[model samples]
Target: MSNQTFKFKQFEVNQDQCAMKIGTDGVLLGAWASIEKQPFAILDIGSGTGVLSLMLAQRSSAEVLDALEIDAMAYEQCVDNFEGSPWGDRLFCYHADLAEFTEEIDDQYDLIVCNPPFYSEDYKTENTQRDLARFQEAMPFEHLIESVSKLLMKDGVFCTIIPFKEEDQFIALASALNLKVDKRTRVRGTINSEIKRSLLEMSFCEPARSDDKNVINTTELIIETTRHNYTEDYINLTKDFYVKM
Candidate 1:
């Protein structure tokens, strides 16, 4: 709950130097993202403190788990976190911007995950680090999709979490790049609250040429029934990581 550190069942993420602390969005994506085939290689963009990559390392037997972090402080923290984990040998961090990494790296990953900055509001924060971590301008959706297309294997899955309102536009943009949503989950804070986030799994595989255009699998997840009252679905999905769960 604090910015200092987040202790998970299998790993501890120290975010004291990172602008974005561990939160529900990252946990949800880490736990909910489908790793059906047990990918051989995985990549986490904007890795922050490398929580997502750590979670994937705990969940799957992936041989390689690489992370990319642009911020110097966050990149250093991410490397420290990865090195301290049990899967340290299999985990690695690249301290470079997405554009540079994409341009220089030729190896493709079986899975790519990103919890990108989706806030497009016209506002400025005194903290430049927080602004860079929270603003969409730092990494636009188009650039993210383009990089994913190039860095992901042909059948690789791209999982991400974004504002629920951006779902349509995001899907459309990805579709333009031949990425189709294979699965999607609309996330709400409570049963009565409006959807706040969307967890999406997209790939290059196209839907069957059938009459039904809505081939994407869709579902909904309610995190809580009331204040601090976690839902069974949420607990079931994240019980492996969260201490309280």
Candidate 2:
């Protein structure tokens, strides 16, 4: 629960050096992103503490797990966290923004995931690091999708978590680049609350199990029945990582 470090069931994440600490959005994306393809390689974009890559390392036998972080401190912290983890050899972190990483890394990944910054371009605070980590200008949806289209293998999966309001626009952007949504989950803090975030899984084509018309398998997730009272679906989704779940 502390910003300094978060203790997971299988691994520990030291987040003190990062501008952004561990949060529910990151956890949901990390746990919900499908590895059904049995991805041979995985990439985590904007990996704040490299938690998503670490989680995937624990869940999959993937030989390569790479993470990218733009901030120097966060990148160093991410590397430290990965090195201290059980999958040290399988994990590595790069210190560079998405654009630089996208341009330099020629290899494609079977699975690519991101929890992108969504704040409006008009918004700003004096805190530069936090601004870079939370502003949309830093990693616009279009640029993100375009990079993903190039970095993803032919049959690869691209997954991300974004604000519910941006879901339609985000999907549209990905669609332009030939990335189709194969799976989607709308998330809320509680059953009574409005949808807060969208978990999206996209690929080059529609899922083989369904027709092209059925672009996505949609679902809803309510995190808690009430404060500290977790929902079964939520718990099941995160039980593998959350110690209390």
Candidate 3:
């Protein structure tokens, strides 16, 4: 296991030497994933170092939680993290792609979460391993929709985060797969910056109230402000995991 610990409000994630390390995107998705009323079972696609899975385990009362990772190294790391966590018995990691796992797996989950690779055409690094983890060619938007459509239970919900620029196209693809946008959050880096990411939760049926936006400025707006200091709202939202706010 990696020696790095991702301290959260109630838990700490030890992620080191994993192909996909813990990042702001995963943290936001983990903290933002809707677990209202609690879910009986949950799934995390592209589980990476299992940060989202760990976060869900800490926040919800789900009895069964599973994570699927296509990368061999990441799958192993996820398994290790799960085994070391308090919810070890209830959490499991599958070393297979989503499409392949869905074909043989029969169980359905109430909630599913994913922080998928969104850089479809972005320039990739020379490292093939890192490219596989960061690039989108491994799992395109279309493929994600199809896989989620097949894996999610009739009453289940699928949640994910993507680049804000892809919002319109993502919604269209989800619609084609029979999934409706249940909730949408447009996130901005700062008050002055343009929207950069969109956190989406989709269901089989349309939500009565769905669209919402949140402006999260993680860093200090003024030069006198110290780094790592967060706003009140940001602190409140992620206080559970970050050791220092």
Candidate 4:
């Protein structure tokens, strides 16, 4: 639970050099993101400690696992984490901004995942690294969507976790780009708490003409039933990574 490092069942992420440490959001996205097609290539945008890519490597037989980190410190830390991991041969980190990467990379990925910063409000902390990693201005939702539209394969799945309040707007933006939501899950901290996050899976493929609608599969996930009490669904989803789950 320290910022220095996070120990997972199959991997240990040393995040001392990174501004963003391992968190529930990344773990949830890593574990919940659909790997149904057994993606041969995967990309993780804004990989902090390379934990999300590491988790995907552990779960899938993907031959190529790439991650992108704009921050120099986090990028170096991500490369170190990936190199130390068992999937070192398969994992790689690019020290470039999303825009540059998207413009340069021509290869499309079977799956793309991003746990983006959502703090859109004008706020600043003395810690510049933390601010860059926590603020949405650094990588707006529009940029993320545009990058995904270009880098994702026609049948590829794009998964992301964002603030629940932004779910509608996010989906609308994706829809404008012809991306349709295939699956969605609203997440709450506890049974009594309001929805805090939304896990979404979208694809560029259009629905059948006969169907016309996207037919999104929606569900809800409560992380805990009470204080420190993890729900069975939550545990089942993340138990493979979190040691104590």
RMSD of each: 1.3, 2.2, 4.8, 1.1
lDDT of 3 by residue, 169-224 (tens): 99899888778787777776665677788888888753435563332223221111
lDDT of each: 0.94, 0.91, 0.79, 0.93
lDDT of 4 by residue, 1-245 (tens): 56767888988899998887788999999999999999999999999999999999999999999999999999999999988889999999999999999999889999999999989988699999999999999999999999999999999999999999999999999988989899999999988899999999999866558757668899999999888899999999999998898
Cα lDDT tens digits, model 2, 190-211, are 9899999999999996445543
Better of 3 and 4 by TM-score: 4
Cα-lDDT of candidate 1:
0.94
Off by over 4 Å in 1: 207-214
Q: Which prediction has more favorable lDDT, 2 or 3? A: 2
Q: How accurate is candidate 3 locally (lDDT)?
A: 0.79
Q: What is the RMSD, in Å, between candidate 1 and the native fold over all Cα?
A: 1.3
Give me the runs in candidate 4 sitting further than 4 Å from their true place.
207-211
TM-score, every prediction = 0.97, 0.95, 0.87, 0.97
Alpha-carbon deviation at 156 in model 3, angstroms: 1.3
Error of 1 at 15 (Å): 0.5
